[model samples]
Target: MSDPSMTTTGTMTSTRSLSYIALFAAVIAVFGLIPKIDLPFGVPITLQSLGIMLVGCLLGPKRAFYTIGLFLVAVALGLPLLSGGRGGIGVFVAPSAGFLLGWWVGAVVCGLCMRQFMRRMPDAKGKSLLIAAFLSSVIGGILAMYLFGILGLMLAAHLTLVQASLAVLAFIPGDLVKCVICAVLVQSVVRGMPAWRLDRD
Candidate 1:
C-alpha cells in the first residue's frame, strides 16, 4: 500500500509545479502586451523573448518547455496572448511563426545549458551565474531561435536563404542586449531570493 504521507507530498509537488507553469504563462502574456516594432522583413520585435529566457533560466529544461508549451496552446486557442495582440490559428501561418515555434526549442536549449553549467559548478555564484546565464541565452535564445527564424522567413516570405539570413541579422544586436539583461536579472533573482531557485534536476 502506498503511504498516505507520500501521496500528499506528491500532490503538493504537482500543485507547486502547476502553479509555476501558470505564473510563467501569465508573465509571457504580460510580455506580449508590450508594443512590438514591426520590421521590413515582416517579423516584429517584442519583449516576449525576455520572458522565455527567464523561464528557461528559472524553471530548468522540463518545466520551461512545459510552461512555453502551455503559453503556445493558449495563443492557439484564440487568446490575444501574442505580441501586437495577435493570436489564433492564423498566427501560426504568419511570417513570424517560425520564431514563435522556435521559442519552444529555445527554452529547452537554454534550460539544458543552464542545467549543465549549474551541475558543473554546483556552487555557481555572482560572476559564475552571469557567465552561465549569458552562454545559455546565447545558445538557446539566439542560435536556436535564428535557425528557425531564418527558415521561417524563407518559407513565409518566399525569400532566398541569403536574403532571409541577412534579414535576421537586424535582430542580432537587440538580442545580444537581451542576453545581457537576462543574465543580470537572473543573477539578481538568485541573490535576492535563494529559496525561489528551482530544482536543476
Candidate 2:
C-alpha cells in the first residue's frame, strides 16, 4: 500500500536533484569560458578549478561527483567547453587531461571533507564554515588535482618528475587565492541558507 503523495514527492525530489546536477555542469562550462594563460611548459592556467571547488562545497560528495562527470561527458562529446575553447577527443590526450580528469576526484574529495566537517560541527557558523571550506579546497582542489596534473605533465610533455613538479610552482599562489574565494562564497551560502542540507536529502 504505497502512498501516492509520497511517490510523487520522491519523483519531484529526484527531478530537482537532476536539475541541480545539470546546472552545476553548466556552471563549470561557463567557468571554462574565461580566457586561459598559455604556458611554454606544462598546461595552461585557467579559472575552471574554482568551479570544481564551488560545486563540491555546495553539492555534497555524490552529487558533486555526478556534476563533474556530466561536465566531462559534455567535453568528451566535442563541445568547446574547456578553457581556451578547446575540445574533442584530442583534448583527452593533451597535457591537461589528467588535471581535467582529476577534477572529478577533487570534487568528491572536497564534498566529503565538507560533509564531515559540517557534520562534526553541526552548529558551525559562517566563519567556521569558511575555515572548513578552505581546508577542504586545499586538500582536494589543490593537492589532489596537482598530483594528477604533475603526472599528466610528465606523460604528455615528457618532462621529468622533478621538472613537472617545479613547473607547477608558478600556479600555487593563484590556486590558493581561488581557495580563499571559494571559501568566502561557501560561507556566505551557509549563512544565508542555514537549512541547506549537504546531501540535499
Candidate 3:
C-alpha cells in the first residue's frame, strides 16, 4: 500500500507548485496591462516580455515554461490579459502571434541558460549576476523571440523575410533595455533575499 504520509507530501508539493505557477501567470497578465507603444509596422511594444524574462530568471526552465503556458491559455480563452486589453482566439491569427508563442519558447531557453549559469557559478553576485542575466535574456528573450516574431510577420502580414527582419530591428533597443532591467532586478533579489532565490528551487 502507498504511504499516506508520502501521498500527503506529494499533494502539498503539487499545490505549492500550482500556486507559484498561478502567481507568475498573474505577473505576466499585470505586465500586459502596461500601455503599449504602437510602431509603424502595426506591431506594438509592451512590457510583457520583461515579465517573461523575470519568470525565466526566477522560476527556472520547467516552471517558467508552464507559467507562460498558463498565461497563453488564459489569453486564448478570451481573457483581456494581453497588452492593450487584447485577447481571445483571434490573437492567434494576428501578426503578433508568433511573438506571443515565442514567449513560452523564450522562457524555456532563458530558464535553461539561467540554470546552467547557476550551476557553473553557484555564487554569482553583483556584476556576475548582471552578466549572466544579460546573456541569458539576450539569447532566450531577444533572439528566440525575434525568430518567432519574424515568422509571424512573414505569415500573418505577408511580408518578405527581409522586410520582417527590418521591422524587428526597431524592437532591439527596447528589448536590450528590458534585459538590463531584468538582470538588475534578479541581482537585487539574489542579494537581498537569499531564501527567495528561485534558482535554488
Candidate 4:
C-alpha cells in the first residue's frame, strides 16, 4: 500500500513545480515591459534576455523549457507580451523570431550546464554559483542565443550573413550585462533560500 504521506508529498511537489513555472512565465512577461532599443540592423535589445537567463539558472532544464514555451505561447495568443508590447503571430515571422527560438534552446542549455556545475562544485554556494551562473549564461544566453538570432535575421529579415553577424554584435554587450545580473540574482537565491528545491531535470 502506498503511504498517504508519500502521496501528499508527491502532490505537493507537482503543485510547487507548476507554481514556479507560472511565476517564471510571468517574470518573462514583466521583463518585456522594459523598452526595447531598436538597432538599425533590426532586432532590438531588451531585458527579456536577463529573464531567460534567470529562468534557466533557477528552474533547470525541464522546467526552464516549459517556462519559455509558456511565455512564447502567450505571445502567440495575441498577448502584448513582447517588448514594446509587440505580440501576435506576426512576431514569429519577424526578424526577432530566431531569437525567440534561442530563448527556448538557451534556457535548457543554461539549466543543463548549471546542474552539472552545481554538482561538481564543492561549495555549491560560495563562489559556488556566481561563476557557474555567469559562464552558463555566456554559453547558453549569449552563444546559443546568438546562433539563432543570426539565423532569424538572415531568414526573416533577409540580411546577408555579414549583416546579420554585425547586427547580432549590437546586442552582445547588453546580453553580457544581463548575464552578470542573472548570476548575482541566482547566487542571492542560493544563499538566502538554501533549502528551496524546485523540480529540475
Candidate 5:
C-alpha cells in the first residue's frame, strides 16, 4: 500500500490518493442514506459527519480533506445521498448547506489538530485518542460547521446573525452527541487497526 500523503515521486500524493478519497466519499454517501433525526432548524443530524471525523483522524489531514471534497462532489452530482434522500443543486441552496460546506474545513481542521496533538503525545492510547478526537471534533470540526451553518441560515432562512445563532441552538445537543460518537469510533478504529491510518505525515 502507499502512503496517502505522498505520491510515487514522494511528494504529496494529491492525485494518486484519489482512490482512497473516493472510497471514503462513497462511504459518506452510503452512511447519509440511513434514516436519521432531522432537527427543526433544517439541519439533519446524520452519521455522515461522524464518518468525516473518522476519515480525518485515520486518513490524516490531506487525505481526509480530499475524501470530504469528493463527498461534496458526489452530493453536487445529484446523487440523492444527502439526509432525507435529498439531492441536486437545491441542497446547496438549502439552510443546511452551510453545514454541508463546512464538512471540508471541519475535516481538514480536525485532521490537523489530531496530527499536531498526536505528534506531541506520540503514543496516544484509546483514552488519549478519544480525548484528542473529542476536542478536535468540537473545536475544529463543529465550530467550522456552525460558522458555515450560521452563514447559510442567515442567507437561506433570512435571519440576522443573532437570530441565526439562536435558531441553531436547537442543533447543539445533537451535534455534541455526534461529536462524542465520532470520537469514540475513531479511537476504536485506531486501536483495532492502527495500520489503516494511511499517512501520519
Candidate 6:
C-alpha cells in the first residue's frame, strides 16, 4: 500500500480522505447499536468508546478526530447514535455532555499513542499489542474522558469535585471491563486478521 503521509496535490485527494472519514464515522455510529447499560449515575457504558479507540488505533489522529467529530454531529442532529438510543440536542446539553465532548479528544490521544507505539515497535510481538491496546485506552480514552466528564459533571450537575469523583467512581468496574475488552479485541483482530493491523502503513 502507498504511504498515507505521501500527500498528492489536488481536490481528489481531499475527497478521498473525506470518504475515509465518513466511512469511519459510520463505523462508530453503527457500533453504537450494540447493547448499552446506563448506570444510575446518569453515565451509560457503551461500545462506542471501544469503536472510538479502535478507529484511532487504525486511522491515526487526524482521521480519528474527524470520525469522532462526525459521530457527535450525527448525535446532535437527532440520530439515535448515542447510548440507550438517545440522541438530539438534548443529549449534547445533558450532564454527560463532557463525555460526549471528550470522545474526540480521546480519539486523538489514542491515535497518537497508537502511532507512537507502532513506530517504537516496528516488528511488534503479540504481547506488545495487548500492552499497547491497554495503555492506549487508559491514557487516551479513560483519562481524557474522565477530565472532561468530571468538569462537565461539576458544571452541569452542580456537583463539587469530591462529589463528582465519588459519583464517577461508580463506573470504574464498567470502565475496567471495557479496557479488558479493548485489549482482547485488538489483540484478536491484529493476530487473526493481519490486514487490520494499521501500523504497517
All models: lDDT?
A: 0.89, 0.86, 0.88, 0.88, 0.78, 0.80
Clashes of each: 0, 0, 0, 0, 0, 0
Any idea what lDDT model 3 has?
0.88
**Residue pairs whose backbone atoms clash in candidate 2:** none
Instruction: Specify the highest-TM-score model's number.
Output: 1
The TM-scores, one per candidate, come to 0.92, 0.91, 0.90, 0.91, 0.84, 0.82
lDDT of 1 by residue, 106-143 (tens): 98889899998888887888998999999999999999
- Give stretches of model 4 more than 4 Å off: 36-44, 197-199
Name model 3 segments beyond 4 Å from true: 1-9, 37-44, 197-201
lDDT of 3 at 100: 89
Where does model 2 exceed 4 Å of error? 36-45, 199-201
> Is candidate 2 or 3 superior in TM-score?
2
Best-first order by lDDT: 1, 3, 4, 2, 6, 5
Which 10-residue window in model 4 sums to the lowest lDDT?
A: 192-201
| Candidate 5 lowest-lDDT run of ten | 7-16
lDDT of 2 by residue, 3-102 (tens): 9999999999889889989998998899899887655655566889999998888888889989998898888899999887988889889887889878
Stretches of candidate 6 off by over 4 Å are: 1-19, 37-44, 192-201
| Candidate 2 TM-score over all chains jointly | 0.91
What ranking emerges by TM-score with the best candidate at the front?
A: 1, 4, 2, 3, 5, 6
Model 3 residue 150 CA deviation in Å: 0.5
TM-score of 3: 0.90
What would the per-residue lDDT of candidate 3 be over residues 66-105, giving only the tens digit for each residue? 9999999999999999988989999999997999888999
Which candidate would rank higher by TM-score, 1 or 3? 1
Clashing pairs in 1: none
